[model samples]
Target: MKRFFSLPNEIFSLGLSPGALALYSYLLYCEDRKTYQCYPSYASIGKSVCMSVNTVRKYVAELEGRGLIITEPTSVITRDGRKHNGTLRYTILPIRNAVDRYNQRRLRQLEETVERMRIRKKLEGNEEHPA
Candidate 1:
C-alpha cells in the first residue's frame, strides 16, 4: 500500500536548511501509521534525498537539535545470537508546538515594534506641543 504523510506549512517557517527539509520530507514519507515513526538507514535516506550518507547524518542531527524529531539508537539480534546495530528509530514531532513558538516570537516582535512607535509618537507630540 502506498503511504503518504502530511506536511504542514510551518515547515517553511521553521527555516530549515534545504538538505534538512529534504531529509524531513523523506522521513515523513517513510512514517508508518501503526508505529508513528520510521527507521531508514542513513544510506537509504541519502539515496532518497540525493545526499551523501554523511550529509544525511548531518541534516538528521540538525533536525534533532531543532526539536523537530526525536531519535533513539537501536539494535537487533539475529538467529545466530549475533548482535548488530539496527537503523535509528525516528519519531516525528507534531509541528503545532513549533508553530506556537514561532507565533509567540512574532507576536513579541510586533509588540515591541508597537511600543517603540508609541514612544516615538509621544516624544514627537511633546516636542510639538512644548510638553
Candidate 2:
C-alpha cells in the first residue's frame, strides 16, 4: 500500500525554506486523517527527511513560527515510575489559516512601504519649494 499527502500551492508562497517545507510535508504525511495530529520523535523525522536531528529541530521551529504546525512537549512514565520526555506531538494547522496570515503580513508591509514613499515624496516637494 502506498501512502500519500497533498501539499497546498499556497505553501510555496509562504517563503518557507526548503528544509521547513520538507518537515511540514513529512508531518502532514504522518498525521492521522481524523485528528491531523502525530507524535514523532525528532530522530524519526530526521531519518525520514534526510536531515540531522538538529536540522529537524530547526525546521520544526520554523514551521511553528510560520503557524504551519503546533508542537507540544510530551512526557512518558517509565516502568520504574520515572518520567522522561517523549516524542513531540505535532498538530498540523490549516493551510488556509497560514495563507491568510501570510497575505495579511504582506499587505501590511506593502502599506508601510507606500506610506514611506508618500512621506519621501512630500519631503522632496517641500525641499523643492524651499519651505
Candidate 3:
C-alpha cells in the first residue's frame, strides 16, 4: 500500500466535521488508482478509523454532502432472488476543484464586504476617492 499524500489544507477550509475528515482521509489512503476512486466496505473503513460502522456511514454521507466524495451504492440479486448490498464506489473530488471553489467563495465575500464599506462611508458623508 502506498501513502501518496497528506490531507490538504483546503479540506479543513471546507468546514467538514472531524468524522467526515477522518473518513475522507481513509478513503484517500485506500484509493487504488490515479483517479482517486475506491471501493471499500463500511466495516473496513470503520475499523481503520476506529469508528462504528454506523458512524462511518454517517460521516461518509457528510463527506458526500460537502462535495468531497461521490458515492455510488450498488446492489446485486442472487439466483435465489436474494438481494445483496454491493460495495460502495467512492470518487474523491479533485483538490484543484475544491480550492477553486473556496477561492471563488472568498472573492464573493470580499466583494460583499467592500460594497458594505462603501455604503457605510457614503452614509457617513465621506467623499469617495477615485481609484
> lDDT of each prediction vs. the true structure?
0.88, 0.94, 0.84
Cα lDDT of model 2 by residue, 24-76, tens digit: 98998899989999998999999999999999999999999889999999999
- By lDDT, highest first, what's the ranking? 2, 1, 3
In model 3, which range of ten residues has the least summed lDDT?
A: 122-131
lDDT of 3 by residue, 1-131 (tens): 95576777778778678888888888888886687789889999999999999999899888776667888988889999999999899999887776677678889999999999999988677455544
lDDT of 1 at 79: 100
Task: For each candidate, give its TM-score against the true structure.
Answer: 0.74, 0.94, 0.69
Rank ordering of all candidates by TM-score, starting from the highest: 2, 1, 3
Identify the superior model by TM-score, candidate 1 or candidate 2. Answer: 2
- Show model 3 residue runs off by greater than 4 Å: 1-16, 79-81, 126-131
For the record, the alpha-carbon RMSD of candidate 3 to the native fold, in angstroms, is 4.9
Clash pairs detected, candidate 1 = none
Clashes of 1: 0
lDDT of 2: 0.94
